[model samples]
Target chain A: MSEHILETQNLTKEFKGFVAVSNVNLSVKTGHIHALIGPNGAGKSTVFNLVTRFLTATTGKILFEGRDITTTKPADIARLGMVRSFQISAVFPHMSVRENVRVALQRATGSAYHFWKSATSLNELNARADDLLEQVGLLSHADALTVELPYGRKRALELATTLALDPRLMLLDEPTQGMGHEDVGRITDLIRKVSANRTILMVEHNLSVVSRLCDRITVLQRGAVLTEGNYEQVSADPQVRAAYLGGSHAA
Target chain B: MTKIQARNRLYLLLVAIVIGLLAPLVVYPVFLMKILCFALFACAFNLLLGFTGLLSFGHAAFFGGAAYVTGHALSVWGLPFELGILAGTLAATVMGAIVGKLAIRRQGIYFAMVTLALAQLIYFLCLQAPFTGGENGQQGIPRGFALGILDLSNNTTLYYVVLVIFSLGFGLVYRVINSPFGQVLKAVRENEPRAISLGYDTDRVKLTAFIVSSALAGLAGATKAVVFQLASLTDVHWHMSGEVVLMTLLGGVGTLIGPVVGAGVVVTLQNTLSSGPLNAYVPVVLGGIFVVCVLAFRRGIVGEIKALIKQSF
Candidate 1:
């Protein structure tokens, strides 16, 4: 078995009287694309939140790189080379695409507190940001303010920013939540290209995208894991079909 | 060098500084000092409000608290003017750390309220503190020369001193906002969750901005105490806090030159109004300006100008 980059054993989350995510086990191997697919309110995002330390798990162990990081702070978790993109676009609207990428690069490289040095003077940092922007296909729009970009481009910028962190694991919460068909296709391709190096655990609602991109699939329903396998095996499972696929097993 | 933008901001700043230095020769030295002092104060407040997006309502605590400390040191202990100001600034920095730690726990309006309430508590403390001299305040503070070489009793020397300090404070504020740390603060302001996910501890960033802002406000207040040769209850009052906010807002909350312009307008208005028969209505006029600015001109003067320039471009 390949070494798991992230593992959660008996992970659970409770909100007031209700359990949002219950007694779930998740294992994401290194350098593979794992997709968490679920219906609305199925706690897929909550699992992402728990792993990223945005929301604490009520009970469980989260092992990152073979050590327990269950109660680590979000920033610390990010610093340890795990970063997440938001469900909605979270680019700095007033800043240019280049500026947004530069900020991320500065933060990741531990130079965010370089008071005497001007941001523009950091030649290497600027170059890195430029390269990432090019990779995300935002080179032409680098000078444009983020708010001026279309929805798909903003999502691409978010990916570029996440890439700046040099993330060992990338947690994407609906990377293509609001994209049209062409945009979705572009992002799906981008994700595949990105997953060539880093481990990607994404929460995807689009079944076709999930089946297309995910190397392994985890189906979640009512805050619990329904089933888990490769796309073919999980889609063929009768319980998964009844509860999640709605009696469809075309795959 | 991008042709130095032809505007040559550095040249502009030098010209402005030269104009400021020559002001006392053409106008009243006292009035010039007041403008310079308040300009520094506004710049300090702008560091937090504009750059960090953390609006502090207890800035008067630093401004007035430093005044009280500097005044006491000058009058009672007979400390040198520079030493007294240093002591005052140190006091404010300490107060700022305490208040910043508490206020940064809550964001937006809650942070504002917590700072205001904490400042009010400091005001009460000053009112009861023996050295503060109560409502009478500490008066007749000595404005000694620089290292006992320059005579602050001379108006020109004093004006030049104030001018240099104001320029330094203004330059510091400008430098901070343009730095990488400042970019991070902007990132935090624009999208905090994104900042956090990028490995930034935003609470720490906010706290650092708050402390730096408070310390600078204290520095301005200490300078003002020496300029006026007195520290009064007016420095610590909540009204003073409101005035700083008005200055920053009227100038342009996030723009570099906005607070300075705002300070000039407010100080000039107050100076003019004080000599006129409408002196008592100054507060009403200030209140009106605030309301009008918030409603009709949300961008303020500098912001409006920048927008126009960008549109023309």
Candidate 2:
């Protein structure tokens, strides 16, 4: 097995006696695209939240880079090089597309606290932000406010902002939940390009994307791990097909 | 901003400075100073409410609290003019740090209530505090020498001093809202979770904004105390806080020129109505303006104008 960059031990979350996530263990390799998949209310999003420290685990531990970070604040996790993205596009709506990536890059440089200096002085970060936008195929929309971007492009911008952190491991919560087939292809390629150097853990509903992009898959049912395997092994499994794929046979 | 837009803004700034320089010659110097002080106060309030999405209801505590501190320092302690303003501003900064530390623990309306409660506490303390002179307040404060050179006893000299300070404070506010730190604070305002995920300690940013805003508000109040030569209980009253909010809302909460225009209009209305037969209806008229602004022009005066300009250009 390759080295595990992120691992969870009995990660459980409960809300008012409703166990959103229960006794689930997961591991993500250092240089692989791992996926978490489940049916609706399978606690897939909850698992993402738990690992990112957005929600405290009712009873469990999250380990990143071999350090137990179950209690680390959400901001601290990002600083530790484990950053996450929201399921919905979360760009700064009123700011320009270029500015969104610039702000993220500024945060990475520990200069987000420089109020005395003008923001125009941050032109030094423009080339890098431009490069990130180019990576996401948003170089043409740099000057446009994010509110004006099309849905697919907004998601691309969100990805660009995430990329600005140069994170060691990235947690993407439904990176392409709402997108056209063409946009999905674009984002899949983009993800493939970006994932060459870092680990990515994503929760996706599109099984095809999972099959093509993910090296390993973890299936969750009712807040617990049902199975773990490669796409072929997991898709061919009778239990996973009935519980998740609605008994539909995989190609 | 584009080159054309930047040049236009610079032109506007020059025009405003010229107008301010010549304003006292036409209008009463005391009245002009009153408007300038309140304008500065509103801008400071906007730093939190407009830019940071923090609505602090206890700003009167800083405005009036600093007035009292400066009034006492000048009248009772016999300090120089500049030193007294500095003392008062420092006191407000400390208050901002303490109150911000407590209030930032809660957000939205809860944050507003926390600030209001703290301001109320300060109001009571001022009422009972000997230095504040209770209900009568500290009166007849001398206009001490500025820099031990220029005598502020002259109204025109003091008016120019107040104008320069207001200009500096306004410029600083403009600089801050356009700074990188300010951009992060805007990010915090737009989406707290997104800002946190980007590795910004949002609470610390909010606290710093609160302190800077408080200090500037105190500067305005200190100048007012120096101008009027008195610090009254009315300054610290909750009504004063509400008035500043109204001024900001009417001017344009987020627009740079909004508060200044709002202050001028409100101050002019007060001066025009308070002495005339409409004295009893002054509050009613101001209330009417608030209703009209909220119902039809939610962006306030300057924001509406800015939108129009954007459309036209």
TM-score of chain B of 1: 0.97
Question: All candidates' TM-scores?
Answer: 0.96, 0.97
- Tens digit of per-residue lDDT, candidate 1, span A1-251: 24999999999999997999998899999988999987789999999999999999999999998879998999999999889999989899998899999988887567677766765655577788899999989999988989999999999999999998889999999999989999999999999888888899999988889989999999999889989999889888888878875686443
Taking the tens digit of each residue's C-alpha lDDT, what string does model 2 give over B1-313?
8999899999998999899999889989999999999999999999999999999999999999999999999988899999999988999899999999999999999999999999999999999998899989999988889989889989889999999899999998998999998889888888888888988888898999999999999999999999999998888999889999999999999889899999999999999999999999998999999999999999999999999988997
Off by over 4 Å in 2: A248-251
Can you tell me the CAPRI class of model 2? medium
Worst 10 residues of 2 chain B by lDDT: B185-194
What is the DockQ of the complex in model 2? Answer: 0.79
Task: Put down candidate 2 lDDT per residue, A76-179, tens digits, no spaces.
Answer: 99999988999888889988999999989998677777878888988899999999999998999999998999999999999999999999999899988999
Question: Which portions of model 1 show Cα errors greater than 4 Å?
Answer: A245-251, B1-6
B1-313: candidate 1 lDDT, tens digit per residue: 2457536877877798688867787999988889888888999999898888889999999999999999988888889878999999999999999999999989899999999999999999999999999999888888987788999998789989888888888877877787888889899999988999999999898888888899899999999999998898899999999999999999999998899899999999999998999899999999999999999889888888888987997
- Interface RMSD, prediction 2: 0.9
